[model samples]
Target: MNMPDPVAVFRTEAAELFEQIESGLLDLTHRLNDKDQIDAVFRGLHTLKGSGAMFGFDALAAFTHHCETAFDRVRKGEKPATSELVAAVLAAQDHMRALVDRPTDDHGDIGEVLLARLRCAVEGDAQQPASVQPNPAVVVAEAPKSGSNTWRIRFSLPVNSMVNGTNPLGLLDELRDLGECKVLVNTSAVPSLDVLVPTDLHLSWDVTLTTDQPRSAIDDVFIFVLDDMQLDVETVTEVPVAEPVAAVSAPVPSTVAAPIPPVTMAVQAPVAAAATTERETAVSNADNRQAKAAENVRVPAERLDELMDRVGELVIAQSRLRQLASASMDIQLRSVSEEIERLSGELRDTMMVLRMVPVGSLFGRFRRLVHDLARETGKVIELVTEGETTEVDKTVIERLADPLVHLVRNSIDHGLETPEERRAAGKDEAGKVLLSARQAGGEVIITIKDDGRGINRDRVRAKAESSGLIQPGAVLSDQDLLQLIFAPGFSTAAQVTNLSGRGVGMDVVKKTVEALRGAIDVTSQTGEGSEVSLRIPLTLAIIDGLLVRVGTGRYVIPLSAVEECLELSLEEDLRSRGRSFISLRDSLVPFLRLRDLFRTGTKPDMHQKVVVISTGTERVGMVVDQIIGDHQTVIKSMSKLHHDVATFSGATILGDGSVALILDVAHLVAAGQQQEAQVRAAG
Candidate 1:
C-alpha cells in the first residue's frame, strides 16, 4: 500500500480553489454589491492561504495573503467591491496558481507588482485611511478586547489528518491568535508502539480561550478541516475564577504553541470532564458534517483511468470465454459464460457512469475566459451557455477543452463584430456568443455560436486560391468551401493579432476532433453570424454496436446510429445496382455498398442486409452480407499508418478473436450526401 504524496494532493486542491476564487470574482464583476459573492471569494482565498502554509507552499501562502486582505477589507465594508478590485484579484489568483505549481522557482518580484495593483484597487483614488491600511501581521494577531467572551473548544481530527498535510500545531496557533488561550493534548486513543502507524494522528485537543471575535471566527480557523473533524465549542457563560491548579498542570504539547502564560484556566478541566457535557447541537452538527464528507470520495483521476482499463480487459476476457463456451456443448459451461457476460456488461455500464461528468464543469471555466477576452478586445461581448447539465465521458471532456477554447476564441475574434461596428450595422451594441451542448445519437454535439458579422465567403475563397489549397474558380459546394477554413495554414484575418491568425488554431481544432473519432460542422449566413458544431463520441472506451459482415470483413456500426435493418433481396439489389438508391416510405435514400468500398474482391451474399445509420439529419444505408447480433465493443484506436482511414472510426476484438472495424457514421453520411448532390446535378 502506497500513500498519496501530500504535496500533489494539495496542488490539486489549490487548483480547485483557484477555480472557485476565479468564479466568484467573475460573478462579483457583475454585482459588486453582492455580499454573498464577496464573502465566497474571501473564504476561498483564506482557505487557499491557510492550506498553502500547511503544505509548505510559502510563496503561495505569502502571495495569497495579500489578496485575502483585499477581500477582507471589502467584507468589513471598509472598501467597496469595484471592477478594478475584481480584476486585480483575478490577476493575483493567476499568480497564486503559478506559485502553488512552482513554489521553489524564482517568481522574481511578480508578487510585489500584483500587490501594488491590489492596494491601488482597494484604496482607489482616495487617500488610504489608517484603519483600512493596517499591517497584515497586526490584522491577524490582534489582541482580544478587555471584556471578551470565554469559550471552551475541543477537537479531534481524523486519524490520517497528519498524513494529508494538516498541521495540527498550525491550527492551534491560529486559536492562540484569537487571544489568551490554553491547549492540552488528549493521548488516550494512542495505540501500542507495536501496532501504531507512525504517520497517523491519535491525539485530540482541549482548549479554553478568551476572545472578542465572534463564533464565526472560530469556525474560520477550522473551515478547511471542518468536514472530516469533530469539533465542539460552547460559550463559558459562567466560569469560576479559580477551580483547580491541575488544569494548568501540563505544558502545551507542540513547539509552535505560544509562550503566553495560561490565564483564568478554569474554563474546563479535562477531556473526560468535557465529554460528559454533550451539547446536542454541536454533536449533531459534527455528525452532519461527517456524513456530508462521506458522500463523496476524492479519488485521483489517474486511478479512475486505471480502473477503466482493468474493466476493459475484463470485458475482453469475458468475450473470449463466451466464444469458448459457445463451441463446447457443456450446459454448465455455457451457463457460466452467459452469467459472466451479463456481469461484464453491467460492470462496463457502471464504469462508464463513473467516467461521465457533467459538461457544466467544462463550461464554468469559460466565464473567466470571456471576461478576460472582453477586456482585451474592448468588445462588449455577452457569453451565453445552455444545456450545461448534459454529460459526456470525462476523457472526452478533457480532450475537448483545448479545441473548445480555440473555437470560442475564433468565434469572438473572427465572427463577432466590435460594438461600434455592430451599432453601425443596425445591431445591438453587445455581441452574443452562445455555447451549448446536447446529445445526438451516440455523439455529444457542442456548438459555439456567435451573433455578429458572418464569415465572408469571398475572402475565404480568395485566400484558398492564393494558398493553392484550391484552384482558382474551382466549382465547390458551400459546405466544401466552408471547410477550407480548417485547412492547414488557412486564415482569413487581414492582420495577425495575439489571439489568432498566425494561421494556427483552426487546423489543429479539426485534426484534434478527427483524432477523437469526431466530426466538425460549420454553418454561416452572410449577415447572421456563424455556428461551429463539434460532434464527438460520448465515450472513447466502449460502446454497444451492431455487428455485421460486409464481404469477408466484419464491421461494427454503433447501435445508437442504427435506425433499422432491412433485408435486400437479390432482385431488389440488382434493380438498384447502378444508382444505389433505396426507396422507403416515399423517400429515396442513398446506400453505400461496403463490400465494393473495401475492395474485398468477393461476391456478396444472395440476400444482403442494409443497415441504415444516421448522423444528425443525414441517413445512409450500409449493405452487408450478414447481420450479426449486438456485441459489446471495446474501442481500440487504429495504428498511425491506418489512422487516416475515414471509413472506420476504430476497431474492436470479436468473441472469436478477430478484429471488427467500427464504422464512422458521420463520414459515411457525408459521403452519401455528396453522392446525392452529384446525382441531382447530373439530372
Candidate 2:
C-alpha cells in the first residue's frame, strides 16, 4: 500500500516526455514535410510545459514555453520544420531534462547559450519577428463592456487544491475583473477543530457577475484546478434597464430571484446553455471512464518478479514430486504429480510471455543515435530498421543495449566513409546503415550493416601484426583476419577522431556478446560493404534442454541447437577417435567425443549417440552414451569461481535432483573447428 513519491513520478514522466519530444523532432528532421511528426513534437512540448507548471516546476515551464512556441509555429505551418531547428530543439530538450532533474543547480550561461542558438535557429539573423502582436479587432470582440449579461457562478476548490499550489483567490480576483461581481464564501461542510485538516480548503464560492465576456471567460477562472473541483455557472439575466444604488445596504438573499430580460435574451437562450450542458456531460463521462480504467487492474513490477520467483520454486517442487511419485507404488500420487506437472508447465509459459517485450522499444532508441552520429560525423547517413516487432526476454534486451550502441558507433565511425569519399567511390553521398532483427529457430539475430567501404583484410592483418596481436606471416582466412578488428587495442584508422578510433568499441562488443553466450559473425565483400551479426538466445532464464548421459554423468544441450540425433556404429566411432569425422549423405562433418573431453574413464555404451549441433555454418557431432527425453530447464548461472569455465554456459537441475551442465555451443563449435584445422595441418 505504499504510495509513490509524487516528485519522483513527476521526474520520470518529464524524462519520458523529453525523450518523446526528441524522437519526434529527430523524425521531423528526416522528413521535413511530415506534419504528423511536427504536431507530435509540438504536443509533447506543450504537455511538458503544462505538466511542469502543474508540478510547480516554474523554471522548466518558462524555459520549455519558448521551444513549444517554435514547434507550435511549425505545427501551424507558419514556418517549415528544418534540420537546424530540430537540432537546436534537440539540444534544448537535453537542457530541459537537466532542469527537471536538478532545478537548483547553477546552469549559469548554458541557458543563454542555448537560447541564443534557439533564436538563431527559429528567426535566423532577423530581428525578433515583431513579437506576434495580437490583432486589435479580435481584442475588441473579446473585451467585456457595460450593459452586459449577468452570470451566477458556484464553485468549490478541491480540498487539497491549495496544498498542491492552486490559488483560489487569484481565480476569484479574475472573476471580479470580468465585470460587476459579488462573491460569497460557503463554509457549510467545514469540520470542527478535532477533525479538521487546516491546510485543506473547505470554502466554496457563489458569485454573481454581469459581463460582456463569453462563458468561456467564466470557465477559465477554474481551468487550472477544474479536473479535481466542482464548478457550475449559469447565465442569470441581461443588465437591468434601471441602475440600482452602488451598494444595496440590505441583507443578502440566499439565492438570486431575478428573471431573464428580453433585451439580450435572444443571443443567450438556447445556444450557450445547450453547449455548456453538453460539454459538462462529456467531461463527466470521460472522467468516469478514466477512473474505471485506473481501478480495474494494476500489477507492480516487483509483484510480478515475486510471482516469477514463486513459480521457479513451484517448478522445483514439482520436479521433486515427480521423482517421489515415480519411486512410490501409489497410483493416486502419480496422477496428482502428473497434473501438477502440467499446471507448472503452463504457468512457466505464461510467466515467460509476461517477461517478453517487443524489440521495437529497443529499436526506437537507435533512431536518435543514428541522427546524432550522422551529425557528429558530418556524413549523410540514413538508418533503416526492420523486424522491430520481434520480442525477446526483457533481461536480454536490457543487456544488449550497451553492445548494440558500441557496434553502431563502430559502424558509423569506422565502417562508413565521409560524404566526399562516398561520392568519389561511385556511391551515393548518403551512406546507408541497415539495422535489422528477427527471431529464427529460438535465437534472435541482430545485424548491423553499412553500405560503405568494406573491411580491408590487409589493413587488419598489418595492424594485428604491428600490435603484436598476431604472428607475422600468419596464414588465416578472410573471416579470421577481419575478426582481428575485435582484438584489444587494434585499429586500422589512420588517425584518431572523437567519434571512435581509440581501438576500444569492437573489442567490448565481442566481450559482451560472448558473455551473453552469443556468437558474432562477420561478412564482407571487397567493395560492397560489411555486415556484423549477433546471434543470441531468445531468453536467458530457461530453455528446452535435451539431457544426455556421457559416461556416468549427465549433460544437457540446448534443444534449439540440436538438429537431430543419430546412432553411431562401433566401427565408425573407433575410426573417428583421433580424427573425428562423420559421413552424412555425401558430406563430411566433424564430431567430438564427450567421454574423452571430460576424461571419463568408463567405457562408452554399446549404442553411442551422436547429437548433431550447429552454430551458423559450422556443424559438429557430440558423442554420448544415451539420449534422455526433452525437459524444461530453468537455467541457473554458475558461481563467479566457475565463470571462466567456457565449456558449459550454465547449469540446470534434473527431476532426480542431479545437476546437468548446459553445453556452450559456441565454444564446442570453435573447439571442433580447431580440431579440424589441426587434423588438416597434420595431413
Q: Which candidate ranks first by lDDT, i.e. highest?
A: 1
lDDT of every model, 2 decimals? 0.84, 0.80
What tens digits encode model 2's per-residue C-alpha lDDT throughout 1-683? 79777677788778778778878887777699998888678768866876777677878877886787677566656567778888988888888988998988998777667767776676655553367533321211222233466677889877888777576766776677567788888989899989999799999999887676667556645543566778777766554435453333232354756664665568676757875775575477558857886985544567777777788778878988988998999999999999999999999999988888888888888888888888887999989889999998888898889888988888888778898998888999888999899998878999999998888888888888899988999888677787888888788889988767788888888888888889999998866889999999998876888989998999989989999899997887887778799887898778899999999999888899899999888899999999977878878889999989999999988877888999999899989888888888898
Model 2 scores a C-alpha lDDT of 0.80
lDDT computed for candidate 1 = 0.84
Number of clashing pairs per prediction, in order: 0, 0
TM-score of each: 0.84, 0.82
Please identify model 1 stretches exceeding 4 Å from their true place.
127-165, 172-219, 223-289
Q: What is the RMSD of candidate 1?
A: 6.5
